[model samples]
Target: MTLKKLASRAITEIGAVLDSALPHQVEVMAAPILNAKRIALYGVGREGLMMKSLAMRLFHLGLDAHVVGDMTTPPLGTGDMLIVSAGPGEFSTVSGLIDVAKTAGAATMCVTATPDGTVPQSVTHVVHLEAQTMANDQEGATSVLPMGSLFEAVQFLFFEMVILHLRDQMGLSANAMRANHTNLE
Candidate 1:
């Protein structure tokens, strides 16, 4: 296949995966971030990178968002939220953190390809992205991309859309968000 053909295929698959995500789920996920006194985010591998991107966006939005395991991350409890991604459904580390967050009285939200899976089923809220993750990315998978790339790519797009929704709902201007960006860079 030509490079152009491959790129088209990739884009089409991404759109299909993203289309499966429900708007109501996105609203529910964003609601906690808007109301939480503090928000902590986590994920493993490439998924973790996506969470960090979201953390940066939340900070630019003037929210108290932290990446879990970061040195400056504070303890989460009531009025706090822990947003995590475990796209195949559950990673042991993700599940452990969710257990701790729940016990600490923090609201837990999960973004996963398998909402019916054990870890997501345990969360307070979930935004299901029906993309191909490593768990199902073997023979016969629909995505032209390899492994969990589809899930990770859609995660970035989904989080960006969530940020847009959040900005509109909070009546925040782009300039205000830009003002919060690091000036040292």
Candidate 2:
């Protein structure tokens, strides 16, 4: 296939995934960010990278957001939130962290393609990102994106839309968010 065709295919696939995503799920994901005193985010591999992107955006929006396991990350406790992604929804490490957060009195939110999985079962809220992940990306999957790329890509876009809604909900202007960007960068 030509580069143009590949680009078109990717765009079309991503659009289809976004179209089917439930608005209520996104709203559930956003609630902790808006209400928590601090937000801690985690995911593994490409999914983790997407969560990092979201942490950055949430910080720029003036929320106290941290990537889990970061050197500067403080302890999570009451009034804090932990947002995690487990697209296939059974990562042992994520499940462990969720347990820790819950034990420490923090609320948990999970983003997953498999809502019925063990990790989501323990979280306080869930945002179902119904897309193909590496586990289910055999011959019959609809996305042209490889492995869990579709889930990760949708996560990046979904987080941006959540930030947009959050900005409006919090009465923050674009200028205010920009001002929060690191001057050192």
Would you list the C-alpha lDDT of every candidate in the order shown?
Answer: 0.92, 0.91
Q: What would the C-alpha RMSD of candidate 1 be, to one decimal place?
A: 1.0
Candidate 1 residue spans exceeding 4 A from truth: none
- Most accurate candidate by lDDT: 1
Candidate 1 residue lDDT tens string, 41-150: 99999999999999999999999999999999999999999999999998999999999999999999999989998889999988888899999998789888889999
**Per-residue accuracy of model 2 over 1-185 as CA lDDT, tens digit each:** 89899889988887777787747767887777788999999999999999999999999999999999999999999999999999998999999999999999999999999999999988999899888999899888877889999899999998898999899999999999999999996
The residue pairs in collision within model 1 are none
Residue 76 of candidate 1: its Cα lDDT?
A: 98
For model 2, what is the C-alpha lDDT against the true structure? 0.91
Clashing pairs in 2: none
